[model samples]
Target chain A: MRRTPPEKPADYLPIAFPAAMLGLFFVVPFAIMVAISFFERVQGGFYQPAFTLANYGRFLSAFFGEILVFSLFLAALVSAVCLVLGVPFTYLLTKLSRRVQVAWLIGLLGVLSLSEVIIGFAWSTLLSRTAGISNLFVALGLMQQPRAWTPGFAAVMTGLVYQAFPYTVLVLYPAFSRLDPSLGEAARTLGASPLRAFLTVIVPALRKTLIATFIIVFIFALGAYLLPQILGRPQHWTLSVLVTDQAIYQSNMPFAAAMAVFLVIASLVLVLLANMINRREPAS
Target chain B: MSGRFLSRVFFAALALFLALPLVVIAGVALNEKKTLAFPPQGLSADWYLQIFTDDAWRAALVHSVLIAASSALISVAIAAPLAWFLWRRVAPWARIVQVLGLSPFILPPVITALGALSFWATIGLYGQPWTVVISHGIFFVSLPLVTITLGFATIDREIIEAGTTMGADDRTLLKTIVFPLIRPYLISGFAFAFVLSLNEYIVAYMTIGFTLETIPIKIFNALRYGYTPTMASVSVFFVLVAVTVFGLVARFGDLPKLLGAWDEGER
Candidate 1:
């Protein structure tokens, strides 16, 4: 049961600042962005407020279609990789002592808050020829010689996965930490093997969270603007990278706004779906 | 037993994987040559020194700090009241307001960045540093909003009742009680927004373009031309700042609680 606070004249006072700021900045900008998406792009690095579908029509082109498909595929791969690795890691993290868990949490937070630019630079160096791990492999006679592995698809995937891994763990942390340990113990007592107990108990228990986590990570990866540009070839560029390029380099504001509008709607739909799944799950 | 051993190995490998890039970057930062290389021919602190001494790098660092600090203040300013209002008053519209506060972060940052870009352009405030500051402040308000809300929830209702019985009004009680209690949450929230704003690239880039060079924008520009050990040094510096900030948060704050881990005492 919930009790509503009594309506007071002063109640509106505290909310005034937030409403003004968000309304003026966030709401207004997004509205403008949407409106601009419908405008026509003119020559000489400008656009007009005239009605035109040509911007949205660009989406039908093979170039835009290919980029969209690649973006979706790459995002799916990043999310799947994060989920596969993050779930078991988070589960194991819960099994650790409190002090160890805090340390791990700190590490995760540190990585999570780090700028994408730094991560991209770090990965670029790590995957570079002169200082790359391939050199270590060569030293151990596992490979013929050192070679750079970046400026390609694998580099982009690795960077995105690394970037997303911490987020996945953080989102799953609350649920896993709150999970009832007795359920697993009971399964074990019923002659289930350890892996079987985990499969039958833990995985099913967190199914909703897993689904939501998958979609959330999917959304995050889809909007990776920096990593793909830094690590991947042009063909591997995600829609986000292309959006920045078009908006900045190509100076095509209308087309860029249209693409961004599409990205926002897709992300919005996925987020709503995740929320729906989460709401469906009974409160712990 | 094998399963346990293998799992341990996997976890170790994952940890190594996470640390490897940072370690490599640190090594590259210490290299003698200007090239981004490990196993340096000789050690040199020149690149690290260069971050402070060089004009472009130094200006970007200072600019990033300025934006981060002011934006963090603005974030707390916007979030504190809204969260306080929600805690003190529970209207139906409270949920809508809360959602609005969080919306900037929930969507992809690129969307938010584009929106800010167009808005600034429309208002003829494009290419202004203040625009980036405000955009970042608004963008990261969700951080402090969540933290301060958590702070308010931890305040026991009985305390408010006791204060009222003592004839303390809303203003006095808030000043004496609520403000003192939520100070740590406020600090943590500020710290979060500051560090993130410092690290943010896209919003800052889109709003102000190259007119104002933050560290990320500077790094991206440098990366476009070529790699340098100086970039690695800056990367190392950033990692240190992130680690130190988060390490303090872990030490002084209820980090697990902040992260939404279930109460241990309850279990």
Candidate 2:
């Protein structure tokens, strides 16, 4: 269409509705959370209107520190595992025919659409003693009996990885598919093994994307609230679980808000870092 | 040959691992036993039947459908025009508007939920279904925004120029040329938003509180206390909904391009 003149005052009308909606519901709530994090926690599981740094101070305590550290460690682990498994898998996907690639992509989107609660409990059942993969182990004489895998770290990691794997694949697919097939083929013709060429050439070229995906997945895993509660022990709870606990269960909204503030800040930083990396590389 | 064979085996195993839990949940829903079991003591449709028969499950299903439908409608209503404005006119604030639309999606749902919870409470609108509808609509606006932008990319500039040279106003042009061309994307965006809203839990739980029950909240409560075959059946229902929604999107739209994996000059 011919370019419409920019002089129409009506040009600005469409932005008004969505802008106000986002401002009120999205930006305003975040502002409230920030303000509430500075409020004082009171007796009887309530918060007072006094200005205080106590909530932030609470985050500096050994207990909260441990929770934060463990959450970070778990998120890092999940991202690493996703990268390890996702890289090869996406590479293989790129090697497939376009029809098969589309089919796999559709299947992945279906899995990705499944809610965390469903994914969590589905894995819980799969790892439960009565009908778990352990039973298959027993049936095949790989082990003597079924074993409960829930209420443990491994099971939690399993669910996290399963949840994150599709995302990892989706994020990496664009980059991997855009890669020149001739690059690897040329490397092979130059007398390097296929595996060796991938490790040396392709992996290095994709280093930025790998890091970006890792940070994206890491931040996502950090915000995970339901998975730990569903699949792991109390010690396995992430900071998100603690935020909900302090807010809803313990009625300590200030503490919960404070923790959420830290969580959001950390996530924002990582997202910004990923954006920077993407800007530098432009491919991802 | 050996290396390729090994790689294929590894890929198949990994694919199976990715799919195992979901497949197992569906299978367990077929169990005739009261308790969940893998081999499913005997095949039956009773559990799936329970989703419709049980009052709480039925209510949750209805509530989820209403919320998702309304949210998708609200999202498309807001995003469609905004996308058109940004695409057609060079506005100074367009980048800011785009960021505002997408920030909810990029931010953690927990943060958005807490914010929405507090924001709604302040406005004395907490625990209302409309709060959830609005919250979800805003949170997922990015999906439609992106889809609609891609839809705009598909419009030929020459056709647009020809329409303008015919003295058609922007409104008439949008209605006649742009809307028809972008109808698939609009539908795809709505479906994408609907599916996401249906699957979302935290924002719905936080904004609406416990007063209104959505399927995810009900599932969370059930899973917390204990596991039941009924819960598995409910999950099966969700998996089916997701499959149906995404399948439709795939059937009608460019699923891969929609997912941000388009090749150069392909679209």
The interface root-mean-square deviation of each model, in the order shown, is: 1.9, 2.0
Sorted into a CAPRI-style docking class, model 2 comes out as medium
Candidate 2: stretches off by over 4 Å: A1-6, A44-46, A282-284, B263-267
Candidate 1 residue lDDT tens string, B1-267: 987897789889988989999999888889887877677768999999999999989999999999999999999999999988888876777778789889887788999999999999999989987999999999999999998988988888888888889999889988999899999899999999999998999999999766989998888888888777888888889878988998898889888888878667867
* Tens digits of lDDT, candidate 2, A213-250: 99998987887888888899999999988887788789
Clashes of each: 0, 4
Model 1's lDDT to the true fold? 0.89
Winning candidate number (TM-score): 1
Query: Model 1 interface RMSD, in angstroms?
Result: 1.9
Please state what fraction of the native interface contacts candidate 1 reproduces. 0.74
Any runs in candidate 1 off by more than 4 Å, and if so which? A1-6
Model 1 chain A weakest 10-residue run by lDDT: A1-10
How much RMSD separates candidate 2 from the native structure?
1.9
Model 1 pairs in collision: none
lDDT of each residue in B75-159, candidate 2, tens digit only: 8888888788788877766778888787777766788888887788767888977889998998889889889988998789889
Model 1, B234: alpha-carbon shift in Å?
Answer: 0.9
Name the lDDT value of residue A171 in candidate 2.
85
